[model samples]
Target chain A: MLTTIVILLYICVVLFDFLPSKETRSTKERVIYCILLTVSFCVLILYSLDIKVPGPTEPIRNVIETLFKPSK
Target chain B: MQKEMISARQMFCIIIMFIFGSSVIMGVSSGAAQDSWMSLLLAAVFTVPMLLIYARIIKLFPEKNLFEIIEMLFGKIAGNIIIILMVWYSLHLCALVLRNFSEYIQIVSMPETPQLPIMIAMILVVVYMAKSGIETMGKWSIAMLSAVFLVVIITILFSLNKMDFTNILPFMENDFKSIAAGAFRLYAFPFAETVLFLCLADAMKKKDSPRKLYLYALLFSTVVLLLVILRNLFMMGPGMVGASYFASYVAVKLIDVADFFARIEGFISMNFILAGIIKITVCLMAAAKGTARLFGINNYRKLLLPVSLLAVALSAIVYKNVMEMIDFLRFYTYYAVPFQVIIPLTVWIAAEIRMHKRKLA
Candidate 1:
């Protein structure tokens, strides 16, 4: 899935950032890294966005449900 | 000049806040209830000496991280085995705790989302924090701890009208036998896991008195967690509290001060942001630090990505379903006790023996 690819990309960036370098990196490199991290997290959130939960349709039913529902 | 990393004081606060917030909203509130509050108290009392042992280890080797200490104390082969086990434990604990909260969100909020995406997003933030290093974790935790403390106090104030002390009633209804059983199992989990702080102690900026930090963190976590647990028990009642998966979230949802300002668990979830990130960051840090020491690398950050992906893969593979995950915790409570409590105690004794001999010499 697209989500999987995004996560893979994120992992790459995170691991690369961990490498200890002899010289300070260019700002461009840092920006690209940040961009990549943000994009992947965004993709992840959107992918999860479709997780719709059904709310109570009727108030009376909701009250009744709460009263009777067993502990989860 | 470079910014100083976290001090032992700040690290102590970070560990306490993160651990208290951890799974507190998920499992602890559900199982302990009024009795859960008792569990927190029990955990504190039991962990006090364990904390002292940890302090002794730190005091003896103020400059050495745990992996190196093990290497020094036990020699390379035996030390490597202990390090590997600790790494596995930290990784699995991170995954386990992540799943614990993800399951909570599934139960109470987004029911249709797969657990992986939720967990991955979380791991990313933690990876970022871990990459940044320990000082960030400390500052973030303080900001978070303050916010969560306020929310908890406000929730208690609003819910005072609803609390029924008699709910924890008949104190020993199950008797000391049952209480002790719960204590023996739950004690090491969120409480004694503080042993992981051994890694953090080495990173402290100024000298820290491990005894003071341990006692303060233990006392503070116990008090706040007990309040939250007691609130859940009185607010939800014993039977409901015992059975519910996340009694604290449910309790927070029920907070209706004047019937308009409500659902403060949302604010607390922001705090969850810090705790979740800290949990994973600390786990990764421990694993990386252990790896670096074992391989004798100069640094740990290089291992972060490989380890994160591995953790993600392993987390996905760890349990078949949320039920399996839940069952893991139930079983793991008993399984983790000896390792969390007993192994550390054994190591402490060994360390002590070595220390005494060193002193005599």
Candidate 2:
């Protein structure tokens, strides 16, 4: 599937971009960078697999609608 | 930490483009229908004080962006918390804009193409721009503003034939309360969204005054937006304008000058893309910079790709359909107040106090 290929391409690009610069950065920097990278990859992979992730907008929407509803 | 600085003129262009990001295409403050122009004008006038507040905050610490200012004022932990919140806000805004762009493109140009590829391609450009640094984004804004303005002017001229000045006749039809609410909605959106610019203030040259930059940009954008709204009002009237998702694009679709000069809405789409990119790029850059500061990293570019990818995914999942997106926007005026106004006002007051203390010392 095209989704699998796009996910693979993304992983390859992230590795190619970040791995070579690993030695130049501090451990803290590398950890944060990897954490961010891993998070992005996980989200994209989940999306490619057609797995739904709950978003934060829904709760905000609920609260707004409740608070601003027209009163009869 | 960006070494290259942009002149005030470049800042002006970026601000104008940023405000016009998705508003011009989607129709800002359309709650007032035919009177949306009045809403936008009132919003612009009301924004002058808020603009001064932002300018004064930056002037208080000429060398610092909003992130550094927060860190300095609030100390490390509290400051990082605020920065994280801001980063979240910026990413959320970027996602919303990306979704808007993809939806517009899908509806107008490519009906069959899946949104994933379009969104991926757009995020790629945004990541590259964010990685290239703030000065490059500023320079691009300068070059693109001329073309954007040219498209606006031409669209206005060509669409003049379809415009009916009488369509806007029965103004104030919504009563004073609704119009004021509409003005407040407009204020919360495009006008007040300039708070994000505080993140890029340090990128402006030392000689460039933030007040002038904000004022000039606000005034110019208001004029162009008024013209765009009038075109939509006169061409589509209040009825169809409110019914359509992208009112300006629909209005331009009615332009048929001598039957040879039709389908010129593509230029408006071009304007949309240019402004959208600048807006998203700035948001991504701000989020990345905030992340870098939070993690004590030297370069923000390291996080640009990941953050932008996150934004792309968020855009995909934000709303189920365009109608949902519009519905959220209708409430966005209220939801955005905390980030857009309250937080910035807090920072401005803190900055003023700090400045007074320094003067006394």
Candidate 3:
């Protein structure tokens, strides 16, 4: 159910926002837009499927801890 | 294309609302407990030098945004690398705030509902605001800031009866190190987060002074935040304020005037929504602009939807639950230092050197 909703939202975004401005956009603009949208779509689908996606929080925490351990 | 410009007043209003963003609801500098007000003050003092540096960056390059300044100063390859890092920071900050709001709503108002839909709803509004451009955001901030201030004042006045003024006794009980730590956290999270303002500095008119604008906004926000801390401390006491995640909301929940007027915690939620929208919109705009710069695109608006969708996805999976969300705050101060301090300071020095050389030429 969540996956379906994610798909629908992406479709709306691409159809309404992305496609309508194709002519005015340069080739580079179109390519970058599609790339970003595709990445977002994949991530949303993974999240919807209850699949665990690795986040940056742990790595960031680990790096910070390594660099500067808190006194408190 | 014509540049979008915001008046000094609008810029001031936007900065205050941005500072009040999640800090109002999250209750900043809580590590200092009853002495959190001191921590807040210390944080404001520490932020001044950095704010001056940020202001000077804008003064050096009058009309260009941070990304443009970076590209001009460092040239394409290295500049693009820095822009990507900044884009990540902006997107990450946006996701963090989004997660904060979703967690608050789910825990306080809707326990049964999932956070993804709530995040989506919030991000949609934020995306629309970002797409409307900074001028619209400035106008919106002016209108909503008044409501936020009124709600805060009303809450403080109504809770006066319940406040235990003694809860703030034993000044400096936390020791200097602890207070400094708390101040550092406060500075990194909300105060230094104003670094994002440089991304929107392009919108300020040529006549406006960036240094005065930044200093005034910082002063006003520090006062408001101090009042909020005192109100929360006096109302909830140190013990409850320390224990509760949403200290402001929990503190406001205790307000009871003649039993006729009660349960006005919703006002805190309203404040959160108003302020949080501006925060998220600003972050989203920064990220979209950064991404557009990365790809050499002229219209940042075209990237807003994709950027916002990515932020929503990240916010969804950012943490397993609210505990992890709160836990991240402990590590956030350290994680933020490089972005908040190191980078801007570097840019300022380089900008100053370049300006000196150009004058010599």
Task: For each candidate in turn, give its C-alpha RMSD to the true structure in angstroms.
Answer: 9.0, 1.8, 0.9
lDDT of predicted model 3: 0.91
Q: Please give the lDDT score at residue B143 for candidate 2.
A: 95
Q: Pairs clashing in candidate 3?
A: none
| Residue range B154-258, candidate 2, lDDT tens digits | 988998888899999897887876777778888988899899988877787767789988999999999999998888888889998888999989988888999
For each candidate, what TM-score against the reference?
Answer: 0.82, 0.96, 0.99
Where is the poorest 10-residue window by lDDT in model 1 chain B?
B26-35
Candidate 2 docking category?
Answer: acceptable
Evaluate every candidate with DockQ and list the scores. Answer: 0.05, 0.47, 0.76
lDDT of 3 by residue, A1-72 (tens): 888889889888978998898998889888888888888888889999999999899898888789888654
Better of 1 and 2 by lDDT: 2
Which 10 successive residues of model 2 chain A have the least lDDT summed? Answer: A63-72
Candidate 3 residue-pair clash tally = 0
Candidate 1 structure quality by residue, lDDT tens digits, B10-77:
77768777676565575364243356666666767888878888888878877567777878788889
Q: Report how far residue B248 has shifted in candidate 2, in Å.
A: 1.2
Q: What is the interface RMSD of candidate 2, in Å?
A: 3.1
For residue B177, what is the lDDT in candidate 3?
85
lDDT of each: 0.67, 0.85, 0.91
